[model samples]
Target chain A: MRGADILRFSVHALKGYPVRSVLMLVAMAIGVAAVVLLTALGEGARRYVTGQFASLGSHLLIILPGRSETTGAHPPILGETPRDLTLDDAFALLRSARIRRVAPVALGSAPASWGRRERETTVIGSTADFQRIRHLKLAQGRFLPEIDPRKAAAVCVLGAAVRAELFGPEAALGRWVRLGDRRFRVVGVLAPQGQSIGLDLDEVAIVPVASAQALFDSPSLFRVLAEARSREDLSRAAADSRDIIRDRHEGEEDVTVITQDAVIATLDRIFGALTLTVAGIAGVSLVVAGILIMNVMLVAISERREEIGLLKALGAASGKIQLLFLAEAGLLSLTGALLGLGLGLLGVWAGRELYPALSLAPPAWATAGALAVGVGAGVLFGVLPARRAARLDPVQALSGR
Target chain B: MIRLQAIQRKFVVGDQTVYALNGVSLEVEHGEYLSIMGPSGSGKSTLLNIIGLLDHPTSGQYWLAGKDVTGLADEERAEIRREKIGFVFQLFHLVARLTAAGNVELPLTLAGLPRPEREERVRELLAAYGLTARARHLPGQLSGGERQRVAIARATVTRPEILLADEPTGNLDRSSGREIIELLESLNRQGLTLLLVTHDPQLGRRAARQVQMRDGRISGDGRGG
Candidate 1:
C-alpha cells in the first residue's frame, strides 16, 4: 500500500473508535508530560542553587579553621583537631601574587545598645577589605579605614536593619554603639542587601576582626575570605592560601581552602544526577502507557478481526496488515507526544508563575528524550498485537468465530 | 482460468479430525458464473475461501492463469489476489467508518494506485452503483441494498478478473437479494468471472453452473437452470 493510503486507513480506523483512541492518546500524553515537568523541576532547582552560589562572589576562596575532606558537606567530625587560623595566617596569604585581597573573619553574637534601644545581633568582624571582598554596598559615610591589621580599631559598620533599630530615621554614622562592654563608632551604614548564602546581610553588624576577637575572647580567626587577582588565578590563590596557612601553622596543613568554583561544580554534578534519577522514575510511566497501548491494540485487533479478514480476502498481504496496525500506534504516540510537549510547557509556565524565584525551563535533552521514548514505546509495544493480527486465520476471522 | 486438484482441508476438533474439504477437484472457465451450494458444514464456504486465497488447502495443487500458485509465498499470493481477484461478503463487509466512496477506493489504494486515478475510478463506480447521492454516507447510514451495491462497487473498483462472493445476499430481504443477484449477474455478463457460495437452492440455480457439496465432497456438478 502507498504510505499515504496506509496513513489514511489507520486514521480512519482510529476515528472509528474515538473514545479508545483518545484514551490511548491521553495515557501516552500524561506519561510524556510527567517526564518533562519533573525534569524541569529538577533542573530548575539546580539552576537556582547555582545562581545562589554565583551571587556569593566570583573567583572567591574561603579558608576555614578545620580540614574538610569532602567538597560541599558538613566538616568531617573525626579528624586531627585543626589548628587555629590567625591574623598571621591571613597576612601571609596576602604576599602571594595570585591573592588580590584577604579579609580575616571573626564571628560572634553580641548585643548592640545605643541609648535606650538594644538588639542582639550577629556580629561579623573583618578588615576594610571585607566591604570590597564580600561585595557589600555602603549607604552612608564610608567603610572601615584601611589601617593596621593587628590594631583593634574601635570602628564599626551597621547593617540596614541594625541602623534602623538603633537610630530609627536619624543619621547614625559616627555614633558610638556599645558591643559587649566596648564602645565603637559607626563609620558606615550598609545598603539593604537581601539574604545570600544563608546570611541575612541586612540584619548584622560589621566590626574590625581584632576588636571582634577581643569581644569574643578568642585568638583564632573564624575564616579568611580571599579574592583572586583574576578568574584564572582562583585555583592558584586557593593553593597559595592553603600553603601559606600551613606554613604559618608549622606545616600542619590544618586549614581547608575551598574555591567557589569547586563548590559550584560539586553542586552541579549532584543536581545533574538528581535530574537523571527523577527522569528515570518518570520513565516508568511511559512504559506503563506502552503497555496500555499494547492492551488496547490487542482488543482493537480482535474487535476488527472481520475487517482484517475482509482486507485479507481483498488481497492485503500480512505485512500490510501489520503495517496498518503499527501505523495506528505510531499516529497515536506522535500525537500524544506533541500534546505532551504543549502540556509540559504549560506546566512549566504555571510553575514559573507560581514561584517567580525559581529558574524553570525544560531541558532540551529531557524534551527530546521524552518524545523519542514515547514514540519508541508505541512502536515497541505495538509489535505483539500487530503480529497477532497478521497471523490471524482469515477463514476463522471471516466466519466471526 | 482456474483449476483445483484433490484439495484437502482438515481440522482437529477435540481429538477428532474433521475433514472440511476432502478430495475436491474442480475446474472453472473464464467468465463462468458458478455457485457452490450445500447444507451447513458441507464445506461450500471452505471451498470458496480456498478459491479466494483466504485459506490454504491441506494438500492441493491450485492453478490460476496457468501459474501453479499453491506453494507461492504469502506475499506472492497476496500480490496475485490483489491483481486477479476481488471479494464480496454476506455482511457487505464495508468498513463502517468509511463513506461509500472511501469504501470503493480501498482496493485501489491497497494496490498503490495514484490518488487521481483512484478518485476517478471511485467516482465512476459510485455512479455506476447508483450510490452517487450517498457517496459521502457511512455504511451504517445506508440501507441493505445500498450497502450491497457499495460492496459490489468496492469489489470491482480494482478491476479484478475474478469476483469471489461468500453468501453475498444471505443477509438481505427478498427484493434486495434479487437486486444483488442481478448486480452479480451483470458483472459476470461483463466477462468478470463470478464464484458465489450459497445454501439457498433458488439462488444457486440462477448461476450458469452449480456444484452441490455434501460431507466435504462434491455430490453433483452440472448446468443450472
Candidate 2:
C-alpha cells in the first residue's frame, strides 16, 4: 500500500461516481463555511465594540446624580434622593489627591452660527483641561486658554462638521459664532473624529464653562472633567475624588463615580453575549451538514460494495478497507475546508472595506479551528460507513452484481 | 500435496438440509494430474472450491503440504492460496476492467510484491501463455480462449505448488480447449499438482487419474494409465 496508490485509487473511486462525490463535497463545504463565517462574525463584533469604547476615552469616568441602592425592601418604595453635585463639591474634588488638572463641564443644546449658517448642536462647556481629558485635537487655531475665576471669555472651538457646513471652506478660526444671544470667537476648529456607534463627534461645539454658564443663565456648579497625572493612578484618584465630593455634599452620595474601564467591561459583556447568540444560531447548519455527510457516506458504501469485495478477495485487510474510505472522507473535507477558509478570509476583508467601523480581521486561530473542525467532522461522520464497509462479507459481496 | 478425509459440506435451503459434499475422501500428489467428473449437483465444483481454500467443508480434515488447514482463519487461508495454490474458473473470472497483463499481475500485487517485480513476472507469464502480443487488451477485447489463457497465467504467476481449475476448457472451442489442456499438462509435467473438474469424459481421461462423483459422493476412482 503505497500512499500514491491509495491516492490514485481515491481519485479513481471518486471519478467512478461524480455526482455522489460532488454532493459529499458540497455537504462538507457547508459545514466548514458555516463554522468559519459564524466564528469570524463573533470576533469582528467584539473588536468593533471594543474600538468604540477605546475611542470614548478609557481614562474618564461618568458621574450621575443618585444614591445607588445597596439594599432593598420587600415592598420597595423609592430610595432617598441625594443632594446635587454643586460648584463647591467640584472645587473640593479638585483639591483632593494628586490630581493635576480639572475642568468644570456643563452640557447644553444651543443653536450655533458663523454668519448665516446655523445648526442645533450639543455644547460641551469646559476649560483648557477639557482638551487633554477627552483627547481632543485641533485642526486649526488653538483651544480655550486657562482663565481666572469668574472670568467669562466668549471663545469656542467649532467641531469639524459644523465648521465645514457653517463656513463653507473658509477659515473658521478667529471668526465669531453666536451661541444663544451672545457671540463667541472661534478660537479653533477640532479635527474630524468619525462617528462612534452613530454618535457624530464632529457635530459638537465646545466652549468655555464660564462663558457657557453666563450665556445660558445657569448656576455656577458644573460637571467636573478631571485628569490624573498618570493612567496607573486612575482607580485611587477616582476613589479620592469620590470621597471629597461626598464630604463636600455632606456625605449625601449624589454623584456616581464610574470609570471608563467599568463601562468597557459592561460593553464587553453585552457584545460577547450577542456574538455567542449569533454563533449558536448558525451552529445548526453545521450539525445539519454533519448529518448530510453521514448519509452520503452511507450511500457511497452501499454503492461501492462490489469494489470493496473485490479488494477483499485480493486479500486486502479490513483495516486497509477502512483506511481507504476514511481517506476519501478526509480528502473531501480537507479540500472543502481550504476553500471555505479562503472564502471566509475574503469575506472578512470585504466586510472591513464595507464597514471600516467594523474593522474585521480573521485571526490565524480561526483558520486553524475551521480546518480542524472540517477534518474532525469527516472522521467522525465517516466512521460508521467505514465500519460497515469493513464488515461486509466477501462471499455475499462478490456474489452481488 | 492435497488430501481430504471424509469431507462433508452442507447448506440449508428453506429448512431442508442439502449436502454439497458428503463423506468424500480424495488425494492429489505433486506432479499428478487428476480430473473430477460429475453433473451440476454432483459436488465436483464444491470439491474443487474446497481444495482451493475458497470454501470450507462443514466437517472435514483437509491437509495441504502435510498441515491440517481446516482450522485456519480466512486471512491465513487466503495467504496459503496466494502462495501455494492457483485457480481457474469456467468463466475465466478476469477482472473486466483490467488489461490481460494487469489481470495476470493481480496475484503478485495481492502478495505485496514490489511493482517492478510484479510487472516483470506478469510479462514473463503472459509470454509463456502466448498472450504477450495481446497483453494490453482488456478481457472484453480478447477472445474466449485468450481470456482463459490470461486467467491461467494470473493463476500460475506465483509458481504455486497446485493448480485447481473448475472447467477450464468448457467455454472454449475444441482447438482452444486442446491448447489449454496442453498448457496445463506441460505445467503438470513441471511438478505442479493439478486438479481439474470437467463434464467431458474425454477431457477427464487426459489426466493421469480420474475420479467420478454422483449425488455428493465419490462413485469411482482409477488410474487413467
Candidate 3:
C-alpha cells in the first residue's frame, strides 16, 4: 500500500481507541516537555553567568601579581621572587597604542570612623578611569578628581552600606571621614548593587591610588585593570601590556594577564556541558514513553486481531502490515512531540516572566534532539510489536484462537 | 481453476499428531460454483484455508489457474492472492470505523489503485449492491443484510477470478442469509469461480457441485443438486 494509505488506515485504527491513543500521547508529550524545559533552564544558567562576565566588559583585561607556575617558564628561585605590581607598572600599560584606558587598583582593609560611628570597610584605590572601567555608578556626588599619580589627594567614595552606616541619611558628601588615622573627605557614595565575582561593591570605600598606597603603607599595587581600544584589540593589547610591564620589571614577565573573554568562554563551556547533561537526563523519559507505545501496541494487536486477520486475508503483505503498525506509533509520537514543544515553549515563556533576569529558551539542538528521540524511540520500540502483528497466523487470528 | 493432489495437513497436539486434512484431493474448474459441507472438526474449514493459500498443506501438490503454487514463498503467495482471489467471511469482518464505501474500497486500496480509479470502482460496486444511499454509514449503523451485502461488494471490487466464501451468511438472519446466498450465486453465474464452505445443507446444495467430508477426508462428491 502507499504510505498515505497506510497512514490513513493506521489513523482509523488509532481513532477507534481514543483513550489508548491519548494516554500514549500524554506520556510522550511529558517526556519531550521535560527535555525542552530542563535544557532551557540549563542553557539559561549558562547565559546568565556569561552575561555577568560580559557586564564586566568583554574587552577588559586584568593584570594580576605573580606569574602562573606554567610549564616551560623560568622557575621561580627563592631570592628572585616576582616583584610587586607598582603604580608605575599600571601607568606603563598606556605606552601601548592598543590600550585605551587603565586603572591601577590597590586594596586594603581599614577602620573608618566619623564622629563615633566606626566600621571596618575595604578601601579601593584607583585612578579616575576606574569608574568607567569597572562600570560603577555614583548614587550621590562625583568620583575622585583627575590628578597626578604622585599627588596624595585624600578623597574617598563610600559604598551604600558604608554611607548608611556612617552618614545615617544626613548630608555627609563634604564631611571628612577618618581612615587609619588619615582623614579624607567623602567625594561619592556608590549606589546599592549586587556583588560582582567576589567584590561586594555596596560596602567598598574608593580612594585615590597615592592616598591608598600611603594609608596602607605599601608600595605594591593590587592589580592593574586595562581596556583595549576595541574587542579585536584585546589580544594585541595584552601582549603589548605584558611586554611593556616586563620592560619595567627588569625583563621579568612576572604578571598573569586574564582576558574577560577567556573567563566567559570557560564558563560557557561548563554551562553548555551542563545543558547537554540535563538534556541527556531528560532523554530517559523518552524511552519510557516509547515503552508505553509498545505496550499499548501489543494490546492493540489482540484487540484488532480480527482486523489484522482481515487485512492479511485481503492480501496485505507482511511488510505493509508492519509499516501500518509503525505508522501508528510514529504518528502518536510526532503529535506528542509537537504538543510538548508548544507546552515547553509556553513554560519557557512563563519562566521568563517569573524571572526576567535570566534569558530562558530551548536550545535549537535540544529542540531537534527531543523531537528525534521521541519519534525515534516510538518507531524503534514499535518494531517488535509490528513484527509480531505481521507474523500473526492468519488462520488463528481470524478464528480468535 | 484450482487443483489439489493428495493434500495433507497435520496438527501436533502435545503428544499426538491429528490430521486436519488426511490426503484429501479435489479439483475445481474455472467458473465452477462448489461448496464443501461437513460437521464441526471435519476439516472442511482447513481445506478451504489451504485452497485460499492462507494455510500451507503439509504434503501436497497444488495448481491454481494452471500455475504450480505449492512452493511459492509467503510474499509471492500474497501477491497471487491480491491479484486473483477474493474472500467473504462469516462475520462480515468490516472495519467498524470505515464507512460502507471505505470498507468496499479496502481491496483496491491494498492493491494500491489510484484514488480516482479506486473511488470509481467503489462507487460502481456500491451502486450495484444497492448500498449507494448507505455508502457513508458505518458497519455498526447498517443492518445485518446491508453489512453482508457490503462485504460481498468488497470481495468482488478487485475483480478477482476466484471467490472464497467461508460461511458468509452464518452471522445473518435467514432472510439476509438467503439474500447473501443469492448475491454469491449471481457473482458465480457471472463467470467468477466460487468456493463455499458451510454447515448449512440448503446453502451447500445451492452450488452446482457439492463435496462432503468426514475424518479429514472427502466422503462424498455429488452434482446436479
Candidate 4:
C-alpha cells in the first residue's frame, strides 16, 4: 500500500473504535512512563551525588593516613589512631611545582566561645590555602595567613550559623573569642555553606593550625588537604604527594594519597549498582506491560476479524493486512513513548524545582532506550496478532456463518 | 468464461464428512446470464464461491478465462478475482464506513488508479446507477433497492469481464429484487458475464440459463427464458 493509503487505513482502523485505541495508547504510555521515571530516578541520584562532590570543591584531594585504615582494616575516625603524615610532608607538597596549593589540617571537636555565647563546634585548623581548597566564602574579615603560622595569634573564623547563634545583629569579625580557656580574635565569618555528609560547614569554626596543635598538644599532623593545578595532572600529582609522604614516613607506605577522580569512580561504582537495581525492578514492570500489550493486540485481532476478511476480499494482500496491524501497534507504542518521555522530563523538572537537594536530569541513554524499547515492544507484541490476522482464511472469514 | 470439472468441497461435521459440492462439472460462457438454484444445503453458494475464485475445490479442475484456477494459489486466485471478476452478495457487502461513491471507488482504488481518475470514474458509475443523489449516503441510510444499486455499481466499477451475484436480492422485497435482477441483466447485455444464485425458482427463471443442484451435485441444466 502507498504510505498515504496505509496511514488512512490505520487512522480509520483506530477511529473505528475510539475507546479501544485510547486504551491501547494508555497502556503503552504507562509502560513508557515507567521506563522514563526509572531512568530519571537513577539520573537524579547521580546528579545529586556529583553536585555534592563538586560543591565540596572540584579541584580538591584528601590525604588520609593509610589504605589499611580506609580499606576498613582499622577504625578510621577513632581519636586513638596514629597519623603516618607529618608537617614536613605538607610542606614538601606545598613546595612542589606540579601542585596548586596545600593545607595541613587538624580536625577536632572542641568548646569554642564568641563573646558571652559558647557552643560545641568542630574546629578546623589550617592556613590561608584552606579557604581556597575547601571553597569557603568569607562573609566578614579575611582568613588566616601562612605568614602568621607560628605567631599563635588568637584569631578565629566563625561559620555563618555560629555567627548568627552567637552574635545576632552584631559584627563577629575582629571580636575576641575563647577556645577552651584560650582567648582568640574572630577575624572572619563564613557565608552559609549548608550540610555536606550530614554536617553543616557554616556551623563550625576555623582557627590557625598552630593554635589547633597547641590546644591538642600533639606533635603529629593528622592529614594534608591538597588541590591540583588542573584535573589532567591529578594522577601525577597524587603519585608525587604519595612519594613525599612515603619518604617522610621512611618508606612506610602507610599514608593514603587519594585524588578526586578515585573518589568519583568509587562513588559511581557504588551508585551505579544502586541505579541498576532500580532499573532491573522497573524492567519487570516493562515486561508485564509487554505482556499486556500482546494480550490487547490479540483481542484487537479477534474483534476486527470481519474487517480483516473484508479487507482481504477487497484485494488486500496478507502482507498488507499484517502490516496494517503492525503499524497500529507501532503507532500506539510510539505515542506512549513520546508521552512518557514528556511526563518523565516534567517529573524531573518538578523534582529539581521542588527539592534543590535532589538535583535531577533525564539520563541520555534512558531516554533513547525508552523510545527504542517502545518500538521494540510494539513489534514484539504486534507480530503474533499480525500473523493471526494475516493467516486468517478469507473464505471462512467472509462466511462467518 | 468460467468452467468447473469434478469440483468437490467437503466439511467435517463431528467425525462425518459432508460434501458441499461433489463431482460438480459446469461451464459458463462470456456474457452469459446464468442462475444457480438449490436448497440451502445443496451448495449453490459454495459453487458460486468456487466459480468466483473465492474458494478452492477440495478436488477438481476449475478454469477461468482458459486458465486452470484450481491449480492457482490463494494469492493468484485473489489477483484473478481482483482483475477479472466482481462479486455482489446477498448482504450487499458495501463497506459500512464508506459512502456510496467510496464503495464504488474501492475496486478502482485497489487497482491503483490515480485519485482524480478514480473520483471521476466513481462519479460516472454512481450517476449511471442512479445513485448520484445518494452518493454521499452510507449504506444504512439508503433504501434496499438503492443499496443493491450501489452494490452493483461497486461490482461493475472495475469493468470486470464477469459479475457474480449471490442472492443479490435475498435481502430485498419482491419489487427491489426484480429491479436488481433487471439491472444485472442490463449489465450482462453490455457484455459482462452475469451469474446469479438463488433458491427461488421464479427469480432463477429470469436468467437465460438455470442449473438446479440437489445434494451438492447438479441435477438439471436447462434454458430458462
Give candidates' CA RMSD values in order: 2.3, 5.2, 4.1, 3.5
For model 4, residues B59-174, the per-residue Cα lDDT tens digits are 98988889878877666766777788888888777777778887888777666677789899989988888888999998889999999899888888878898889899999998
Q: DockQ, per-model, please?
A: 0.81, 0.27, 0.68, 0.44
Give residue B64's lDDT in candidate 1 (0 to 100). 89
Better of 1 and 2 by DockQ: 1
Q: Which is the winner by lDDT between candidate 1 and candidate 4?
A: 1
> For model 3, what fraction of the real interface contacts is kept?
0.67
Q: Please list all clashing residue pairs in model 4, or write none if there are none.
A: A154-A185
Error at B16, model 3, angstroms: 2.1
What TM-score, computed on C-alpha atoms, does each candidate reach? 0.94, 0.80, 0.87, 0.89
Question: Which digits, one per residue and each the tens of the lDDT, describe model 4 over residues A1-401?
Answer: 56666666677677767787787777666666776777677867876775677676666667877555342112255333445565667878865566898888877778877667889888877788888888888877888865665546678888898888888898777778777767778888888888864458888888888788787776456678899888787778888887877777777666776667666666676777777676667656555655676788898778667667666766777787888888887777787678877877787788778887777665677678777877687778788989999998877777663
Candidate 2 per-residue lDDT over residues B8-103, each given as its tens digit: 999899999999899999888888999999888999988887887767889989999899998898668767877888877777777666689877
What is the alpha-carbon lDDT of model 4 when measured against the actual structure? 0.79
Candidate 1 lDDT over residue span A366-400, tens digit each: 99999999999998999999999998988788778
Candidate 4 structure, TM-score to reference? 0.89
Interface RMSD, one decimal, each candidate: 0.9, 2.9, 0.9, 1.9
Clashing pairs in 3: none
Q: Output candidate 1 Cα RMSD.
A: 2.3
Model 4 spans with C-alpha error above 4 angstroms = A44-48, A51-59, A68-89, A95-97, A110-120, A147-153, A175-184, A195-199, A210-222, A229-232, A265-288, A352-359, B140-145
lDDT per model vs. reference: 0.89, 0.76, 0.90, 0.79
